[model samples]
Target: MAKKRSGPSGKRGSYAKGVAKREEILTRALDVIAREGYRGASVKEIADAVGLSQAGLLHYFASKEELFTEVLRKRDEADLAFSGFEAVPASADVRDIREGYLSVIRHNAEVPGLVQLFAQLSVDAADPEHPAHRFFIDRGALLRSVFADALARRFAEGGVAPRVPPETLARIFQAVTDGLQLQWMLEPDLDMAATIDVLFELVFTHARAASDDPPDGRAVREGGAA
Candidate 1:
């Protein structure tokens, strides 16, 4: 005899259950990785955390690498949502983006395990053979482009001539943020958000000063007239 076909409701129920199970697995995997770091967390441990056998977990994610990729993707989605940039606003400017970064840093501080996981994985992924190497590379490029675009827009709006190219500024911003994360991981008491704010202040102050200086090295008056 053939298996009986389920109705639309049955199909919907099955789909919903599958999605829930997938999210549950992702959540549990994040928690385990947070505590154990990517290299330290075993597939068996993750599966056990979610009450599944390793083989069963494999049914959802074929490999640990694939699972790690999904976790990183989910983490980005969550960060975007928390940053209030799930959908960019028409009025969003560089200051808005900077605030978003600060907000994310604050959020990460509350989840030290996740921070530790990210720091450890990022360093290990520097090896070309690592599973997350490509992910980090792509992520770095995307973030740099985003920061560059935001800075460029701000420059255009404020007529603040940038002493450095937008792309260069973006790289600087990314470097500072990543460096601060590593430092914060080592010294948990460090205020990452405040440190980032100081970096922004210095960068923007320099940009503003450059914009105010004439080509001949003379400082312009505040009233737009030299």
Candidate 2:
């Protein structure tokens, strides 16, 4: 009668299974929350959707807030993975990054549920006590930083100065993206990608025109013409 062997392999197997179950729960939870919202989806409902009892779900996640926090984290991770930035060359400039954003927006259109989830959670997270408050705050800051850096790079590449500061431009860009997302949610027919492109064009054109102007309000003389 050999002694029971609970070796490293056994532990690894258990860990892998736990990881798989956790991901399954997160996936099902997203679907449930997308359909029912955070307040409407009870612990039991989420558990049942993942083929677990409420108590079993609690073993993996302490509470509904905890579960929802993990879900939001996973959602952001998924979005970053699909953002196409990783495929961009190291030599890529601001315009390249800006173009990448259009692909992300297009992808978001295909997942209205995820977009709705983000919109709803972002609103709910406005409360200081909410679990997702910090997430959204940090997310906004990160977006502003990335956009500012990209815009600055673009301006540098073209030897053009922006009419507005890069940070200010970044905020405006972020606001437009968020506002458009909300509008698109309400009016599904809205062309969010095209609208964002128009915004980029307007901002870039203004910056470029400003860069081309004479600082002393002097007009450029044409060749052999007044």
Backbone clashes in each candidate structure, one number apiece?
0, 0
Each candidate: what lDDT?
0.77, 0.76
TM-score versus the correct structure, for each prediction: 0.78, 0.77
**Ten residues in sequence with the least summed lDDT for candidate 2:** 217-226
Tens digits of per-residue lDDT, candidate 2, 68-157, equal 777888876776767777676656555777777887888777767667767777887889887778888888788777777777777888
Please report the TM-score between candidate 2 and the true structure. 0.77
Task: Report the Cα lDDT for residue 98, model 2.
Answer: 73
- The CA lDDT at 66 in model 1 is 67
lDDT of 1: 0.77
The window of 10 residues in a row where model 1 has the poorest summed lDDT is: 217-226
lDDT of 2 at 18: 71
- lDDT digits (tens) for residues 118-180 of candidate 1: 776688788898767888888888887777777788787888877667777777788888888
Mark the regions of model 2 whose C-alpha exceeds 4 Å error after superposition: 1-20, 31-43, 89-91, 214-226
lDDT of 1 at 200: 83
